[model samples]
Target chain A: MLFMRFRHLLFAIFALASGAAMAQNNPLTGLLRSLTNTVAPDQGKAAATNQPTSVMGVRGLDEVALKDATPAPAAVVELEKYAASAESATAAAKQTGLQERTVSYQKP
Target chain B: MTNFRLPVRFGVRFGVLSLIAILTSVVCAPVSAQTFNLNAIGSVVSGLVEGARVSNISEAEEIQIGKEISARVLGAAPLVKNEAAQRYLNRVGTWVALHTERRQLPWRFGLIESPTINAFAAPGGIILVTRGLYASLENEAEMACVAAHEIAHVNMKHHLDLIQKGALTQAGAKLLEMRSGGNEIKQFAIGQGAEIFTRSLDRGAELDADSKALVYVAAAGYDPGACPAVMKRLAAMKADASSLAMLYKTHPAPADRAVRMEEDLGKLAGAPAGSGLRPELATKIK
Candidate 1:
């Protein structure tokens, strides 16, 4: 009976170790992703077509994702374009001395 | 070693208790005693756990991006170049920034010529305070409070982290700094996620910035009582004008911040004999 009990304890320990390892591997760090994926099937298309490119415009949808796990792809595409444009602009600026034309804003 | 082993149940119990103790210690560790130069272990830990991930890019890359955006923004709509205000804000920001972890960064401070009531921190120690926010402030302490919080954002690398995380772009943080004449980029970046992240600083991040700002203002020998009063005034301003009015709109309302400030007042009550700004001088800036 003692040996059987020890075996059961070993299994529990092993289970806990595996759980920890799985958690370490998880990428969803900031907040837990809800399990139930009852996401609305077709919202990204509507948002992309209708929503203005403003922070507030997308916030309602972000809230939905937080509350109901409804993901929107429109935000992803917009963000990508924005980042790419900024990166290119920055690169272009570096190619020339574009940074020099601006008068120093700080006091000498 | 002698073959002495505990029962499996005892071992498991002991391990669980040890883990709990270690976690508690990690969470409860005080902000370091040394003049926390900001990149020390304590600050990095504080940032990782509570700092706002304002960008996803590397700090060096973010600084480069910030420099690029700042150059462009200033080129189009240059700061007023009012030497008085520039010197004043820089002096105050320098006081706060050195007290933070990322003190070594080439931080620059400026005042933009705009009526909009806002202040913001960009990557690489770049801070911009609009003439509007400056006019609204009643005293140097209030001004310091605002500057310190922005400095905390820089030190915590919140703006840069957000950009890297793809939540905010390099242009977005710059837009926050130069709101007036940045064209559509301002409107565009705001939609990119700055507003949501701006308004809702996680409770921990807010508290961390508050704590550091308070400590910095107090250490600089400004009136410690002034920080709380400034927060209360901002809360009132928000309540009257809708909370989103502040340039650095925090998600946790100013009232919530005021309450926290009140709770921390006891620790910051002692005023050192030094002075921050001459109110008379501050108002005299043309």
Candidate 2:
């Protein structure tokens, strides 16, 4: 039982350490990417001015941000003559699964 | 100015008391989880001050105000006749709007026929991007960038709040006592709204909108760098070009906005690239 307790504690510590590691890996977090970074909005503001090209070095905008934005929920509006005939398109999407629904974050 | 400060002054005593309470909480509680929710405290404090309202414009009235402004825009420049492009823009815009706090709003999108690179967000949820600006977009990410900035204006209620404050300034406490802005006041506010749009929002608000735009694009899975990239393109343009005259007049320099975007841009660095525009959507944009 004592060994099990020790194993549990070890697991908990590892889990927490990994979580911190993920946060540390975040591109936005700067030199001080720890819990202490939240204390001063002013310092955050000051740090912001010199960030980007200064901190990260100048990089191509396209190559840099490729932010992994989560796939957008399918847009509420349908496509291609959708508004003109919503009922038909809705039926087509439901029945034949052929209507083209668009989203912001399309899977490549 | 007198009217502007009246509503806030009524809560001065409560505000001070809350300040003390906040300070005490900060001293006693841990900074993370124990930190007080300023919004929750605000609601509690507001519950005590029922009479302190700056102006009362219902959502319907706000929408009406926006429609009036939108109608004026349409009166000036007809919407582009490309139905496919129109629906495409709506699809992109509505998708971006879903990421915002005010997603439930009846968002409407339009592409007006103008060569000027401009976009406008009216009081409610009407967003119009000019054809010139639309043509300038290299891809859907750039289109989303334009839509998100205007959406940010609506989400933040920047223009609506400005018009509300303007109406109060003109009509004073009468707006408050009336409870809701009456039709007459609404019409007057709409007129003021037109004039306000002709000018520009304050510098801070514009920069705030830029920051919000970056976040919105990122949230919607578009490249957040699209903002700075667009700004860089604008920066390279001749400011005196006829198409850019009104845009230049109403907005701060593109270089300044690009500087403002740097902070948020840093956050986007090394992030996974989002999806590219679908081929059919790309064709519509081109």
Candidate 3:
């Protein structure tokens, strides 16, 4: 249902009217594979209900789902400030070349 | 006699303990720099969990193949000679992945030494954008757009799927373990994966990545407009088929890609998107 808003994003999100719809299952991350829709999901489905949760603040979104809380546009200023400071914050990663800078992405 | 004996014993014990502490520092001094590396510790912990085999290709195997492919790519063209530019790329690339679902991948971003306008994503998050393309970016948001696009491809495992399709009979991760120290099968599979990059991904994959990249950039607080902005730039570039054969062959026409995003781009017109593309970093891209 979340994929509805992204209809303009991929034609694959909407399948052919008469043909058997192909589910483009991306098992790599083992997440969001179910979001691939065969038909145009109802625009009014869970949109309003899910809105508040989806764009809840920046890093405070450690518990949010990827589909629901990708990033609220309103959070842009905070995101920018975060990015601006991210370089200086990650300077330790720079000193070591590419040895290992990333901690495992913990699934919230 | 008892007091003297007890005093002597206490002195001897203290001396031995101090000697042990000195020896410990001497032995550990070389690796003192790594004692506080939380990322390394996380990697080791993740590496252990990564050993649990995935269905066809384990995460470890996928990352290993990505590294091999990276080496081949570097061998052919090498990374750009500019350290500042490379660091900027890593900074942006790392930022985008941090907001993605597959954030734990050993993600890396490099501006390979190529003048052709193109970007490549190998499995397990090894993303390379050509210097020609890097020079064309308008700001950090656009850079995030490109990195997010490639990161989306990795999340979808597009290249890994292609490798599997090409070598399913011998490319299973179980086969990798059965023949330990035998990377021939792995090499063959990786070779197939590398070759897949030489060709274009299916239209569905490319379009899907475009959509997700928008989400990624926005999720990272960069401008979603950058997605359409970058595409419009590519659409403007008059790439000759012979000279820019790889870019020409691999990607769907930029016009078509831009067309798909028109509605979303229109919606984002008034949205407050944040981006801080430093002038210093911008000039170093060359």
Candidate 4:
């Protein structure tokens, strides 16, 4: 009876430990795995090429994006145009918003 | 001739003594007035007083006065036809106004119906830009530099402060008010203030206004260097003697203003490099 109870307790402890580890590794899991491989000379190129640019808040995620992602020239220009349009709209809205007074003074 | 000598000598002596006493009295009276009113310099020729309880002159009495003055001036002058130019100027003015320390002042902008290349700010936030000013401006920054100077006049309460300090006597204020057909009391206040501004003409008001304006211009995300360039254009325009009179009568001449503005520009740091002047938009001026 004692041996059976002890075995069940051990199994429960193992499961909890594995769960905690998985949660901690979730966001940065892929990046960590790739970095670990890069440290190994033979595995570096293979892992680096396969690594994704975007990840869910993983460590060094922004740096990975800078290294791995390439935006098309046309896409960049389109994004800039959108930004310019938004700024222009904001300026125009401010200009048209004011109430102009109609009163006038005569010249002496 | 021989019979008239004694009487003539006595008359001449009396005249000389009277002149000396009159000059002495004239000199002595102002010293007393100046001593009592530390702000006597605040008054203008129009007789408006400052230190009146009005929190904002432009919002208080200047608005009505500005509109009235703008209307009368517009009647005699012709409006510039370029809608885009008007819009552009308003945009620049608005940008500067927003960045100024007195952003809450209900600043109103307008293009006056005149050919003179000048801009003047009446009491309140009434800013009058002329067609000639529009034609001369190279960019938004230039427009703002001029507007900022006008804004300083309003923000500093140079006019209203001048009046309330009793720079214009009760009688002086009433006389000028009657001439302008405005409320004699209000006109009195304005005239006194105008006197202060006129006296400051040779003083540092214009240069100080220019420096203050550059600060606002830069804050509004425009290049501060535009101030010197705008003054350069004004200087060029002033070369025409006919144009000089109108511009000088309202605003100070551009002759020394540009040089001093340039000197100030050199001392300033971190002003932006280039401005985008849309010639297509600018040339739209009539």
lDDT order, best first, reads: 2, 3, 4, 1
- Per-candidate Cα lDDT values, in order, are 0.47, 0.57, 0.55, 0.49
lDDT of 1 at B115: 56
* Error in Å for residue B153 of model 2: 0.4
True C-alpha contacts between chains kept, each model in order: 0.00, 0.00, 0.00, 0.00
Indicate the residue-level lDDT of B209 in model 2. Answer: 81
Query: What digit string (tens of lDDT, one per residue) describes model 3 on residues B1-286?
Result: 9878866866775566556545434333322321121222222233332432234567898887877666555554456767667767877788778778898886777776666677878787778777877887877778888998999999998877765543322222333345553344455556543345664579888988887777676666556777887888877777553324466566788888888865554444223433322122344565
Better of 1 and 2 by lDDT: 2
**DockQ-based class of model 2:** incorrect
Estimate, for each residue in B13-102, the C-alpha lDDT of model 4 and write its tens digit: 556655554543433333222112222222322234332223433366765554444443333343454455555566557656776778
True contacts kept of 1: 0.00
| Best candidate (score: DockQ) | 1
What is the TM-score, restricted to chain A, for candidate 4? 0.25
DockQ order of candidates, best first? 1, 2, 3, 4
DockQ each candidate and list the results.
0.04, 0.02, 0.01, 0.00
Candidate number achieving the greatest TM-score relative to the actual structure: 2
TM-score of each: 0.49, 0.57, 0.54, 0.52
Interface RMSD of 4: 36.8
Candidate 2 C-alpha lDDT tens digits along B159-262: 87765554333233243335443554465456653344555688888887887777666666566666777888988999877677667766899988988886
Best by lDDT: 2
